[model samples]
Target: MKKSDFRYDLPTELIAQHPLAARSASRLLLLPPAPAPLEDRAVRDLPALLAPGDLLVFNDTRVIPARLFGRKATGGRVEVLVERVLDGNEARAQLGVSKPPAAGSELVLDDGTRVAVLGREGEFYRLRFESDEPLEKLLKRIGRMPLPPYMTREPDAADAERYQTVFARAPGAVAAPTAGLHFDEALLAALRARGVEFGHITLHVGAGTFQPMRAEEFKDHVMHSEWLNVGASLCERIRAAKARGGRVVAVGTTVVRALESSFRDGEVRPFAGDTRLFLFPGKRIRSVDALVTNFHLPESTLLMLVSAFAGYERVMAAYAHAVRERYRFFSYGDAMLVFPEREGGTDATAHDSRLH
Candidate 1:
């Protein structure tokens, strides 16, 4: 299919520039599997919508302040968005300049730290910073938040407080698991009180997510690899939950990708490595029975993922409904709870075929 098929006219006025006063206060659009219809609710009502034995899988990959503004040794302006922390003083980053920085070139950061381009790894460049502190400690003190492009503003004090999920722990991701942003401490407590079980996984989101689809055929579009890990303990929990006839609810598209990528044979197995798995229409989902996520950009990979979870027609209808009801869109906007519509025969296309 052509990329144009995914394009929709998203009004600029509906884009949310800032977060709501309360995280869980956002509206929720519920789209059940096919043979059923769509339902609209509030995020605060999540506890009542879920069953006691369902497995709620969350991405605990925390967002780090990865954006660094600096100038090259030649006095040229440069911006670096750290993709991953490889080692103590080494990391991979996307350096923005007229030409990519060559090896051995030095750039001065906003905090007066200097980083020398050490090497190149595919689309990303390796940089070795002059610091004795661990990458996390250095970034927390020096780096600015890597807010999404639509914000049109620099990361400030508020972003430090609002951009991360309440359960963030393993710090590595460059971007936030935005759908998880809606769950506050109280909301999580309510879910726990209802006996909803929780498990954790990690998938450090890459810069590819923010990249717009430039190809016509969706299959031609490629995704960058991101490191992920699904532990054995989590696998045991998921199997137990499934055996008990409970649904596996993925908190975001990242969790869905990680879980589905790790599945082997008839059971979900633990996996540790990089995955470039991409989900779109006609793909079969072996994992993630339900999804909780924010509305995504038109013609973006994230939109395709949601469309894959719910049928394309259902997603389009829900988006139309959201717009008519004046629901917010994107990172700082409202969320959707979509249950996969696979009640009919499976689609002919395997999940990997749509990855391209």
Candidate 2:
């Protein structure tokens, strides 16, 4: 499909700058099965909307403080956003500078730490931290939260906690699974009490999650790879849920990608690797039955993925309705609950389970 197919007008004012005082206070837009009247509700109302046997597959990948500011040896200012940590003291990063540094040049951080530029790998610069400390520890000490570019402000102390989900445990992602951020401990307990089963997947969201497509034909766009680990246990639980007639709801697009990547030939299995799976129109969603996601940018891969899950026209119409209703947009924005289209449907029941 053409990238323009996903384009829609969103008032700049609707772009949320900061999260609400309470995460569960955000509004929820329900895009039920096609032809069903859409409902407007709050995030706290999710428990009542979902069935008792529903399984929510959550992305537990934790966001890392990847934004770093430093200066070159020649006194040139430079900024670094770690795309993916390579090892204990190394990473692939996007470097922003007035003048790009050559290989072998070193950046001296404001904290007095030095990072040696190894070389360029694709669009990212290969960097080696000149410290005995682990990369995660160094980042925690000096790096700032890598907030989305649209937020128009530097990270504050409050962002350190509010930007993360309560279930976040695996520490690798540069971005949080925004949908999961809406579920606080109270909401989680409520869902658990209501008998909603929970499964965990890890997809370390990279800086690439924010990259815009340069191609007009969306299929020509090469997706950026992100690390993911979907265990056997979760797959087994999902299979069990399916056998019992429960729905598998992905908490974020990342979880959907991870789960679907592990599913092949009608079997969901364990997976641990990088995936560049791009879910757009015409692609079949084999496992997930429903989705809980934040409103995405216009003409974005995220929008296309949701469009594929639901129908393209219906998803776009819902987006228009969201704009007309003055709903928030992007990360730190309100949430959306989407059910698949009925016509070009995806039925999880037909797929037999090999997740043992």
Candidate 3:
């Protein structure tokens, strides 16, 4: 498939710049099984839609305050978006500046912390902090929320909490696993009470997630590697759920990648490393049965992955419906519940009035 196959027109007004008052207040668009009517429900209605024995796998990778503003040694302004923290005093980042800094040049943070540009690692520059202070501590003190490019406003204190999920534990991701942002403590408790089991995986979202697919053919696109950990215990839980005939519901695309990357020879095993898995049409989705995700950007790899999980045509129709109904879009947007509908499914073309 060509990269343009996933293209869709999205209205600027539909892009959500800020989050709702409450996490569960965002709307939920349910893309039902083919030939069934689509359902418009609030995120709070998620529990009722899931079965008792179903397992909800979530990405627990926390969003670190990765945006840093600083000046080059020549006093020119520079912006650094941390991609991965290597140690307490070193990291890899994407630098935004008029002129790229050379090795041995020092950049000064607004808070006066100094970072020496070590060298380039592909598209990112390796940086070493000049202080003994932990990188996390410096970031917490001066880094701003790494909000999506679509959000034009500057990050505020509210974004520090709103952009992150309540269950976020491991700190590493530059971007939030946005779908998880819809679940508040109350909704999680509600699902637990209804007998839904949960498992956690970590996939530190990188700044590369925002990069657009530059290749003409979809297969030619190079996926950015991200660190992930799917432990043996989680695999065991997934097996138990499968044995009991329960659905393996992935909470976000991150969770889906983490789980599916661990699948080998019909078995999902423990895996800890970087994954470059690029899901699109024709790729077999052996791990996840259902997905809970946010509306993705047009023509993005994320959109392609969702289309691969749900039929491309059906997903396009759902996007159309979402636009017409004025459901929010993007990172802080509404949620969607989609089941797999392979491309050649008989009912792929069926239209339902409920979508209107």
Candidate topping TM-score: 2
The residue pairs found clashing in candidate 2 are: none
What does the lDDT read for residue 67 in candidate 3?
93
For all the candidates, what are their Cα RMSDs to the real structure? Answer: 4.8, 3.6, 3.5
Q: Summarize candidate 3's per-residue lDDT along 1-356 as a digit string, tens digits.
A: 88888888888999999999999999999987775767888889888888777899999999999999989979999999999999758999999999988999999998888999999987899999888789999888888899999999998879999999999999999999999999999999999998899999999999999998899886677899899999989999998987876778899999988888998978679999999999897887778878899999988988888888887899999999999999999999999998767533311222232122
Give the alpha-carbon lDDT of every model.
Answer: 0.84, 0.89, 0.88
lDDT of 2 by residue, 31-77 (tens): 87766778898889888877778899999999999999989999999
Error of 2 at 175 (Å): 0.8
How would the candidate models be sorted by lDDT, starting from the highest? 2, 3, 1
Distance from true location, Cα of 306 in model 2, Å: 0.4
Give the least accurate 10-residue stretch of model 2, judged by summed lDDT. Answer: 347-356
Per-model TM-score versus the true fold: 0.93, 0.96, 0.94
Ranking by TM-score: 2, 3, 1
lDDT of 1 by residue, 1-356 (tens): 56777777778888888999999999998776565566778999888878778789999988999988889988889999999888768998988887777888899987788898988887789999888778778888878889888877777788887998989998888898998999999999998998799999998987767887888886787787899999999999998987776778899999988988998886789999999888888877777778899988888888888888787878888888888888899989999988766653222122222111
Evaluated against the true structure, the overall lDDT of model 1 is 0.84
- Which ten-residue region of model 1 has the weakest summed lDDT? 347-356
